[model samples]
Target chain A: MAELRKDYILDQYVIIAQERAKRPSQFSRSPPTPSSDKDCPLCPHNEHMIPGVLEQVGDGRGGWLMRAIPNKFAAVGQEGSAALSTHDPLFVHGLALGEHEVIIDTPHHDMEFEDLSVEHIERLLQFYAHRARVVESKPHVRYTALFKNRGEEAGASISHSHAQIIGLSVFPPAVARLFDRAYDYALRNESCPFCDVIRREKHSKRLIFINKTFVCIAPFASRFPFEAWILPLRHVPAMDKLRKEEFSDFAHMLRKVLRRLGTLGVPPYNLVFYNDERQGMFHFHVQVLPRLAKWAGFEHEVSVPINPVPPESASSFYREG
Target chain B: MAELRKDYILDQYVIIAQERAKRPSQFSRSPPTPSSDKDCPLCPHNEHMIPGVLEQVGDGRGGWLMRAIPNKFAAVGQEGSAALSTHDPLFVHGLALGEHEVIIDTPHHDMEFEDLSVEHIERLLQFYAHRARVVESKPHVRYTALFKNRGEEAGASISHSHAQIIGLSVFPPAVARLFDRAYDYALRNESCPFCDVIRREKHSKRLIFINKTFVCIAPFASRFPFEAWILPLRHVPAMDKLRKEEFSDFAHMLRKVLRRLGTLGVPPYNLVFYNDERQGMFHFHVQVLPRLAKWAGFEHEVSVPINPVPPESASSFYREG
Candidate 1:
């Protein structure tokens, strides 16, 4: 029998249909074609291919270990007026005014995210925090999104290990909804909903990993087959607020989950960081969504995903040798 | 420069970033592997492979033109209890008790949806309407989703030309949101928002095809590159409410838009029909979404799509010889 599960905080729901489930091995695909260093823009010698560098993390080797640069094909930029205009009650338009930047996670062209050491991953997290703060401080910026897309299927045009930061002039509707839900939950229950989720899931079958600072769990309403959420045990509202110890734990937990995911042919996935600086009640987290299935008409039409694998099963897979 | 556009009725928004746009010709992919009739279950002589036929449309040749059967690997079934259970505030769940069926669109193995004649397409639409009515009449079914996935990338596991009808026990969150927005809009303006959309887009530059009964247009806030919507001229809330002439015009319009999409190497796409039996003010329509680009980290992070091809450009491409 199929079960419908609701998100902990949001009104979102997903159908967990175990009867239609397939083994993790059945979801693997041929590896993405590797990119060579000869023309890879993010490679150490090819840094000139990218535009202006916004930030860089220096290594002891008198060179940068990572670099942040403006996206050559930015979806949103600072060149336009950010004013909203209404041509009619039915037609609304505005400039997508803000910034888009790419953070090259490593100088090596062949290094995958999961292969990075915990210290290296921690530095990358710090870089993401720094960039988020910088982008959020911009005039008219309302929200900043940080995410990493691995593999071609996951929408990475470039195969280099990297992440993106986008500053938006307006709060994205979905992100705004999350904040609204959190605020309402806090007002009603006098506590953060995500904090409650961490407490409830810490010992549940869906729990994947836990550390002193962070806990990873397969959400009850998993949208994808092996989707995992890494949340801080403490009530941290934004990436910039993360203490050094928290970052280390987050890095370790993330790497453990990603390494386990890699055992399944390193399937393409997206790592999305959610935070809201304006909403103090918001509990920031990172969602690792494996692109194991294509979202067809049903998902687009109804916005209710039918996840074949139960999160409990996925947790077991992650915990397996 | 990138511009943000809002959906006419919903709070949804999309970024039209033409600066990163690709030409329609550039979006083509290799054709999908054709399925042979010998092993294709939906082929004319392979009816025995499917368990039971729920409905069939006669072809006047002592055979059927199309058929609807229960999905063998159904996501939901009628066996389970439909009662909701709350383990805690953080974990709410219920049995997904409903129906899943597949409507094989044609008896021929090689015919693509665009290759079907307008009359044949009309019969297919009529069959869809019949199945929808039957499914929606089931007890506890709150929503019926009708959609077709044309290729593997669009989530079609089989190579046959077929559409799926899922009768869900709960109103999908996204579909429910659409109804809520429409109801709110009607209350504020005393007019159906979709009806207003038809009036406004009939002469807009985004208009693709218009007839007396139906009109097709590239929506202003198209999430996909070549997204098109087909709406009735009248405020018809459900499929059963569509008049004969409206069905004819809709078939013509849908065939035309799909044929145009087919010219672009028949890139994988989804055709979704939106209707509500309970919401009288709901003006139903069909959305044709071309899966030309992959939704990566940015999209998953904020739920805001960055469409490379503007609707106006897509409209011009559809209108071209």
Candidate 2:
């Protein structure tokens, strides 16, 4: 379904399926060690390891299916005012304010997202929406990033099924650029660009899975091998706007795509939720970037990634048994 | 030496050494295995393994100091025309036209860049400039990227010491954006922003090593821990413009800083050369990014990286015996 796709508004290009240098089998690595429940801090009886629980979803058996707690070693803190100041023309900075929290997705220390049941995943999605709303409500919070780092290679310090929500006082430049590009596209096209993308990709070769509410596809301009994007058919600006009924479909789509990705040796990957608190003409979606390859010097300097696996081939692998 | 610094023109911000999350000692990793010369394709006697040598520097001992050859598995090819075309509004692509070549830095398979003599490194630098100029002479080529992938974590496929040059028909979006920002700064300040940076940072805490011709500093807003930028004292638009006398100082500065970086167990890193082929109002420099930590979901999504080690602390480490 996908070919080389340029960024809708930017000059960035990802040369898809034109020339694949490596296949999926070439990316397999040694399996990661799973943490035992006895010493795992995220396990059920180790609540003392964390500062305090911010929220939780009870399992109706005196246990919690999910819990939200502040990250013990937070990257950003609410210690200082968010106002930016300049030391000089070259040195400008603001306090690393706002909040960083973790949502324990399951009680089982060794469980992964693909192992969780659809109903359990749906509840997790609901929790994500609820907590995102809570964090965005903070006065200093300007942008909220909800994402999961699955394994060691994906930057997860603790080997547990969990996700993190970082509330930033400053609007991230990448998201700002996205907003600018989307606004410009809307002005020119008279429609949501993402909606148009869905309409076009749903019938394309890169389509992996499509349901009534959500559609998953290997993005034409995938930066990484097997990179996939899951988008809602309806124009949802942020996770908090999704209706109660939409959670199940979204959860199912996420779980299915992730399970397919498991075919790649359950590779370490990042699942990122792109949501705008400002509710601009942004399309909220989840991007799954598999850490199958390391980005080297060219990628960093040039900023254009050469994806070795074409989206069509990646989609075929995802569609395989 | 470093503090929170913003991009000269962009809204991007990098929080410098405000938090000391982990020390340099904490970044120690297992030593990398050096490939034996007998089996290394880039070894002195394995010239036949590569397609053809585009250029080589004689050591004057019936051997080669450095050799450039086409990459066997090039990411882009010169078979197709460089014209960009769009299949649809969403599927725009162009031929990945240009060249990808590797420079065998040394015949000694076990050697690292830090182990090379300044004179030898200077020769390699000369070779880099020569190849870049040759590549840019092609009618379709618009950009040239010269870089080194030191270890596996830094995305080096072979254990042998080497560097790569990628010539592209299209200008990279990141570099283009950088030019735009620099251009804006010039328009407003009537001077190059990088020249101002050099002037401001010459005696700053972030200064690592400086010589008559080149100065190396830990950038105030580094994305990676211990990230360093090596720049010429005089504003040079590209490597080809470097005066012959400047190469010695540049080589020495690179070697000394890299040796300092070796104190952290010689952590895998990427050395990227930012050269503008168009010879616009740009400052040429080399960026060294140590791969000590993995970039997780938040970094990928927000674009604002949370650097655990401050550049000031990094500068101190680099300055230590």
Off by over 4 Å in 1: none
Decoy 1 TM-score against native? 0.98
Fraction of true contacts kept, per model? 0.90, 0.60
DockQ of each: 0.88, 0.57
Chain B alone vs. reference chain B, TM-score for every model: 0.97, 0.95
- Per-residue CA lDDT of candidate 2, range A46-104, in tens? 87888999989998999999999998777777776777777566777767787889999
Return the lDDT, model 1, position B168. 89
How well does candidate 2 match the true structure in TM-score terms?
Answer: 0.97
Q: Which stretches of candidate 2 lie over 4 Å from their true place?
A: A1-4, A17-20, B1-4
Clashing pairs in 2: A1-A204, A1-A205, A1-A206, B1-B205, B1-B206, B1-B312, B17-B310
Q: Top DockQ: which candidate number?
A: 1
